[model samples]
Target: MPEETPLHERILDTTEQVLRRYGPEKTNVVDVARALGMSHGNIYRHFPNKKALLDAVSARWMHCFTESLSTIASDSKVAPAIRLRRWFDTLRETKRKKIQDDPEFFQMYHTIAKELHDVVTAHVAELLQQLETIIRDGIKAGDFHAKPGASSAAMAFLQTTFAFHHPALLVTRVPSDDEADTVFDLLLSGMIAGPVSKKLRPKVKKS
Candidate 1:
């Protein structure tokens, strides 16, 4: 016998399909309910309202990205420098691929992400905490001499790479792989143990 999908998951799955079909502007609870072959009230039982459902969907989507990064962050076998590089590159690549691969779904979640400000805020906080962990590991490994505490240094690193990580900016101004690599090297050099030479810094091209 086939096992039935959980009701809550069914609603979320159907909602994603509906969002892909009708987009954020047009998708509603009723559409999701219809797609799931259930009454609107049934969806409401799991998700309070249309906005709540969309918020859940947005959270789910963002978590997927965070989970991927978390795996890299927790990998102790990788050197701090290489792990940091992979983390940044994976983040930028994952976001870019989402938009390029399924623009409709990306646009839908991007809209919901704005509407659910707290969700986005908490997501950023969680990612920042993960970055702090990575920075602390780098310090313990004698890779970074970040004078500021790990949390502060992590926040600064995130801010400096804002265009690459921030969702709204990511859609329009995501850095190229070469650009990310150059900026990462410059930033890490400043935070690395001991003195960094001028030769390590890449010269900025004139516009």
Candidate 2:
């Protein structure tokens, strides 16, 4: 006989399906319990309320992308600049694929994300931490010149590329590879440690 799935997993699985089918507004613990052939009280045992259940589902979805980014961030064999580019590309592609493959779930998740600000904030925090790791590695390797700190640099990187991976913007338009590359190259130029090109350098004042 196969091992039974844990009650917590079962509840989460059922809740995800419920949310996908009916969206966050319509999904509830009772619906999950009904689908799982258990009492609503049992669902409550695992998740305190509907908001908690939705947050778990949202977190799980976000984890799919975070795990992949973490791998690229920690890959020391790859140069930090290349890894940073790869990280950004992977994130943009993952979000686009999720939207293309399961639009309903994507829409549902976006709704939950808007309502549960903390969950989205936490997810962004994790992404920033991963980004900081990559930036710090670059600074150590003498490939990057972040003035203040890796943490601030990481925030700037995310903010600059917000349109590519942010759900709100992604739903509106998935930027082309060329566009993303142009933006990334411009951003990378600033962080890269080297003499600034005369054209890009600020004009000095003449006395």
Best by lDDT: 2
lDDT of each: 0.81, 0.87
Which candidate tops TM-score? 2
Residue 50 deviation, candidate 2, in Å?
0.8
lDDT tens per residue, model 1, 114-181: 88888899899988987888889999988888865788888888899888877677667657878888
Model 2 CA lDDT for position 115:
89
Tell me the RMSD of model 2 versus the true structure.
4.7
**What TM-score does each of the candidates earn?**
0.85, 0.89
Over 4 Å off in model 2, which ranges?
A: 1-5, 193-207
